[model samples]
Target: MTKNELGIQAMQKGNFEEAAKYFSEAIEENPTDPLLYVNFGNLLAALNDHERAIRFFEKAIEIDSNTATAYYGAGTVSYNKNDFVKAKDFFEKAMKNGLESSDLFFMFGMTFIQLEQPRLALPYLQRAIELNEKDIDARFQYGLCLAQFGQMEEAKKELSIVVEQEPNHSDAYYNLGVAYAYEENIDKALSMFNKALDIQPDHLLAGNAKKLIEEAINR
Candidate 1:
């Protein structure tokens, strides 16, 4: 097998050291191959060597400006470092360079959220869900984004599915409670909050919401 392929196999097997060795050899064997650098960047990123990972991704981009994966890798490193502005730029470049993946879309959406631009996050999060319906986190984020826009009905629809698909999701229940409360369905909202508290007793928001509802009823 090619050194790059072997490196990927080793990485998948959780042998990061072996993967690094293989990736290094592969890079040495084909210094001009942008894919090798991208792979090394991925390995470094997995190892939490963020600076080195970004360097490798930069090297890949230097080799081929159109290397989409290189931009994606850099974007991820920037995101991990909480450099949302840089992450947003790199992710946009990756998209422009034809990188089309649910993960890429999800990251871009999340970056927008971190930048406090939920309006921009919505479409990308929705696209991520469309690409991979089984991605629960993507759907959850999308639902939250919808809720942020006061699209309560749509948000409830998505959150309802989330709770159905993953019954132990306390946050989904809490959000559903919020949606119900928005609709003035106090009883249903309280029931949803109770479910959230049942799943996670320390869910402060759910607990506080329930208390407020009860207090309001008493008043």
Candidate 2:
């Protein structure tokens, strides 16, 4: 196998030092290969060596501005650092460079969410779900974006599917409760809140919502 391939295998086996050595050798042998830099950047990113990782990604971009994965690597590093604006920029560049993976869409969606633009987040989140329907986190976030836009019925539909797919999803149940409450379905709302509380006993929002419902019923 190629040194880069060996490096990837070592990385997957959690042998970071070995992987780094292999990647270093691979880069030395093929310095013009943008993929090598992207791989090394990914390894460094996994190790939380953000500075070196970014440098590697930049090097890959310098070699080939159209290297989408290099932009994605830089975006992920920026995202991890909570630099949402820079992350968004890099993700957009990745997209412009033809990176259309579900993961890229998901991160782009999340960056918009972090930037407090749920409207901007909705389409990307929806695209992520379309690309990978089994991605529960993307579905959950899509439901949240729907609810944020006051699309309660749509939110309920998505959240309900989440609970069915992952029964122990407390946050999904809680969101369902909120959607039902918005629709004035008190009993169903209470049932959902109870389910959330059962899954996560310390769920403060569910507990508070349950109390408020009870107080309203008592009055």
What TM-score do all the candidates reach, one by one?
A: 0.97, 0.97
Clashing pairs in 2: none
Write down the lDDT of every candidate, Cα atoms only: 0.96, 0.97
Model 1: residues with Cα > 4 Å off, grouped in runs: none
Score residue 194 of candidate 2 by CA lDDT.
Answer: 99
For residues 1-219, write the lDDT of model 2, one tens digit per residue: 999999999999999999999999999998999999999999999999999999999999999999999999999999999999999999999999999999999999999999999899999989999999988999999999999889998999899889889999999999999999998999999999999999999999999999999999999
lDDT score, candidate 1 = 0.96
* Residue 91 C-alpha lDDT in model 2: 100
